[model samples]
Target: MKDMTAFLPYASTANRPPLRPKLAPSGAGASAYATGPKAAKQTQTLRDNDDTELLTLFRNASFEQHFQPGSTVLLHGDPADAIYLVVSGTIRCCTVDSEGRRQIFAFPKKGDFVGVSDIDRWHFTAEAVDHVIVKSIPRLTLEQELAVNISLRLEMRTLMGGLLARRERQMLTLVSTKGPERLYRFLEEFAATRSGGGHIVLPMCRRDIGDHIGLSMESVCRAFSDLKRRGLIDLKSHEKYKLIGNAGRDATPLPLHADL
Candidate 1:
């Protein structure tokens, strides 16, 4: 592969693309965009440059597959011939022990890519949490592109790096955080990924939460109550929760193994 570093400026903090506003400005056109239409156009161009390239690759090379809730989208040890890019709904990736214990690795949602790390066979099983749609791109196609497309190569590296970092953080949290705090942290991160500001739906049930965070269903319920009592979260209903007051950011850090 050629040097991909030059094609991946958006991957770095210093050169990352500008954020697109939820709504365009309302003032005079010149003042609204900070420096007139020319600057605004430039900003838009920079933002869409790399994103358009990647989107084109997926759109041109992938085929869509839909899965119903509880359906297995990918099985552990299955041939890893394609990468699935989530289009809608959630996919829970997990592994089960010989004793039948399950540990969830991730709940990948829209815009997330799966099976990117697999070499020959899947290491985790992916199940649809609801009606799910994904675009599957064959590994051979991506590899051929990567051989000549520097931007795609760099983007792949960036994606893998992010996945590894997230897993590392999850492992550290599981070992060092209390159950209640763990639940709170998960809500915080989950809400951040979602679009609805402080309000978001819990796509998975309490049992799923327990499996993901290493808690029992009863313990998960208790942790929810604890968070509600602490004024960190407001449970609107069985599936909806609203974050309150910094969402426990002000709480003192719990000692490692405090739940023990």
Candidate 2:
């Protein structure tokens, strides 16, 4: 009805190489990219063509669907009849506690798949973060395709492994890091993979960001201020920002570029 992380598989960064700063090798931080370029390269290799092949199969069986901002894509505990392929816009996966506090787990963007983890019922609620389009492929169809196709099955396994790795990295970030560091790391990953030309357009609002990063909205604001103060980011507006340099605590010049 209202609120979800189902460990949704993200789009591969194979086409767009990571824009990492040449920071000296330090202890592994909680940031997802803290594994650095080598780890990212390994991940990219694992994900190669998985999205393309998965989409091709799912598209053959899926029907097109659309939603506006704040619309519920799927409810928690509903039968996991189908998984969704994001064609456009973003899906906010999160849950609400008894106190009505929300916690965001992931934002499933274009080329990402949602509801892949569940076999019978959905674990979290999926909400449209903005105007969205998705391809809804029935669970049975997906299972059948996976069963008959060895190559597809192996690819899906690799894809799921990558998703779990990222989920683990993010969990570590949430548990070990404070608000400002968590927010900065989130921005770094998004800028490296999703944004281009040092420009970032936040699809979700501050509240959503706080929910995702385990901070209050006020804290999220403070974190943004902190980034600005540290010269890590130039906030053109609340929803938009320009990346100035390295977001690391060392505060060196780091430029970000997105091939996509």
Candidate 3:
């Protein structure tokens, strides 16, 4: 198959595609939207944090699914029923070859969406890396609703864009760089994620990371050792990693997106 990531930009989109905004800027054209209950809702959504907005969005979801650790959410050939919104826990997206080799593409966590595909059958399988809860909306429902909800439409588009960016980053970084750079990029991305109180916890195991990046477990371990030796990152435990600044980070590092 063709490597689509080769052509993808290693950085974030310089200018994202313009979405029709619900909140209009001040001026003559803003006359209709400037004052109303709709305008007040938009204003509040803007002022409120992302979690609040996400909560509001999920309140209207068609349904939800829960998966315990190691449970499958989607099979490779399963008919695409709905696009999923992750409420909690980690989802491991992967595929198994004819030889039964597992190649994981990504690990999407909370506040992420999955299962957007062009074909009716799923191209990949999604399983819970940990206990997972996801809200889902049927394809027909999303298409019909998105037409009316501008904000939801924009968000869904943004989610798709985020997936593209992540795949690009993953493939480009894995194939072009050594294990150290891959590890660094992974750490940097996760640092910005659920990390708090001076520590960044890695959600994937060494073997999973190795499989995802086409590296060996030994190589991944070596990369971690090298990072620690250079004081770039401190390994508190197998799962807990603390970022110590980008002491030896790549000058042109990849921007890792989570919603793959």
Candidate 4:
């Protein structure tokens, strides 16, 4: 097995931006987003002057390009020549056991950074959960930028710290809770962090949420039912939710136990 302990310190230094406060539709505002395959194809031609400048400076640095869903972006032992950024779609970071059971580490949304392991190679594999577009930047170049740009370096350090903290909390929840509580906590957290108001636009499916939260798909569905019955949330649609009260207030009173 890969020695993840040694890399914990580095992982602790990433993902610190304030959560984007507004809940705008994907591709509805000034924020740049790469969606499906068609949008990814159009990104190259649609760039304005600023976009072109950034893209050109990093263009010579090439990484692997693939357009397939369920494809492995990086295997457990593959060299981390570069950090992979999701240009479009979702990428699931996960670890698999010798028995081939998989536990998802995180679901990196658009604009999230992946492959932050300090070592030369990744300790986990990143798989495309949908059709994806990824951009890879050389480690050397990243280091160079960090060395020269103090602000950028600090930003990266903060981002890494936040990401590590979030993952650590998720791991703790996975080991200590039942599927229902885990699913509830996951939705509560997602709603609070990403959704601006009562409306929540879910980026991933029930199966994806189940994998990440250490729950079966059926359990996740049942938790949603419980939440709705309690009048805590409403199912706006399959991929959307509307919070009735504060999203996570119900969870606040519960004590942490081995099985929640």
Candidate 5:
């Protein structure tokens, strides 16, 4: 597999740290760093040796399997036995309509976690957008850890919070913004997160982004055109954008970082 870093830009700030796989310990008596407010709060803790060890434990304690591009990792309503970590490659979480149209919920990159739903079954299907390697942690093991590990508890809490926040933001964009605004914001946010020296590589297709942002495919195309026209972004081609600096750029994009 290609080095995951090669596929994406580096973190923009020197102070920013790499993401780690370990969930912080949960339960009482956990360190303050492990616990978050009832709401999600962004934290920038570095990935330490402990976190690396935890990832190793997670991978070795269970088994890892590969899925070819277009393979389904979990179908909607399937039993949610384990949470998946994308060791490499991309996965799209999506839901299908009664008419059988697929609406992608999210495109998770390498190092992103998937299937963290609290329900016994998955609410959406997870399919490999590319050849994918996943480290699976049994749900029971995760639950057990959550019961005892304060740090993990906090980490999980933060993760849930971040998910909710992202969903809320997406919902607002769908309801309140036009297609061009949504697309511009999306590209701007993607660019701001990068090392500031390179273009943002979109891991998914325009159709996938359209579904997530509640835009029609044609509208998604128009939004890209609008951004390019405004000189906010260079449409390097479909699914790629180069930030050229524009007004009304996303403020949170550069500052936002997450563990999963």
Candidate 6:
């Protein structure tokens, strides 16, 4: 659940601490620091622990809500007193350009976090893409709970690390990719986030996809048709897709670390 301006390069530095900290033990335990199965297992265990704690936080916050499709959940510059956890439906976050054209930032999915920025105000407006369910957590409560619980603190630190990694990947894609590549990569990466393999259902329409990826609706459609002709993806419908093998890039995208 990472929602922040981190995906967009910011001119002003954020207030949050470094996501990855140097935790190498000095001298004494250095021998055990070598890469091995135990170290890998420990890393996995840490992630598992953090997920459990995050679930607990969501439950304790107890501010569950449902929004009808197209409802505004938050506005740009709203008081940043809380963050959100989506249980279902997509949240489309956006902001207006200087010329008043709306620019969609992201389509955050189930289990995605919204407003995870450390700033005092929202950076973008968030709207329900469909019927949406979420848990809203006050920043004060989140901070107080983290302060008293060492395990929770550790979990938050780890989660933030993953979020930072994702933000980096997104920024890189946005800065570097061409239209067709961005569209293809976006679909590939978004599909990777689904726990169920293949047969991906895009939550956003073509216009939404174009807005997020900095492309035109025509470009997105053309890319899809191209990929379909190339047999890279099976288009059951405009929104439904089936990913075939041999995409001729890296392996299937790692989940959550997606943008273009």
RMSD in angstroms, all models? 15.8, 14.6, 15.3, 10.7, 15.4, 15.9
Model 2 misplaced stretches (Cα beyond 4 Å): 1-52, 246-260
Please list the residue runs of candidate 3 whose C-alpha ends up more than 4 Å from where it truly belongs after superposition: 1-57, 147-154, 246-260
C-alpha root-mean-square deviation, candidate 3: 15.3
- Candidate order by TM-score, decreasing, is 1, 2, 6, 5, 3, 4
Best by lDDT: 1
lDDT (Cα, tens digit) per residue for candidate 5, span 1-260: 44432212211111113212122232111111122222222234335465643354354444466665555666655577887777777777877654345566677766778877654966676766666677777788788777787777777778879998988777777798777777767766556545666667786667667877788777888778776777667777676678775455486543222211
lDDT of 3 by residue, 1-260 (tens): 36532212211111113212222231112111122221111222223354433345455544666665555666666577667778788877877554345667878888777786533867776766656677766677666766787877676667678889978877787788877778877777767887566776666678677777787888999878888777677899988888776555476343222112
Lowest summed lDDT across 10 adjacent residues in model 6 is found at 33-42
For 102-180, candidate 4 gives per-residue lDDT tens digits of: 5677777555677655548777766666666777666887777667767666666777799889878877878987766
Q: What is the lDDT of residue 244 in candidate 2?
A: 70
Model 1, 90-158: lDDT tens per residue?
A: 878877654345678799999888888987977777776766788877788878888899988788888
Give lDDT: candidate 2, residue 76. Answer: 67
**Candidate number with greatest TM-score:** 1
Measured on C-alpha atoms, candidate 3 has an lDDT of: 0.62
Mark the 10 consecutive residues where model 1 has the least summed lDDT.
Answer: 7-16
Q: Write the per-residue lDDT of candidate 2 for residues 193-227, one digit (tens) a residue.
A: 67568568998888789989999889999989988
Over 1-260, each residue of candidate 6 has an lDDT whose tens digit, in order, gives: 26443434211111113211122121112112111211111122223444566667766553666665555666565567777888889878877544334566678888888877654877777766666677777788878887798987787777778777976787788888777678778877788788686588886667678878887788889878877777667999988998776645576452223432
C-alpha lDDT of all candidate models, in order: 0.69, 0.68, 0.62, 0.60, 0.61, 0.65
Candidate structures ordered by lDDT, highest first: 1, 2, 6, 3, 5, 4
2 or 6, greater by lDDT: 2
Q: Give the Å shift of residue 162 in candidate 3.
A: 3.3
Q: How close is candidate 2 to the true structure, as a TM-score?
A: 0.73
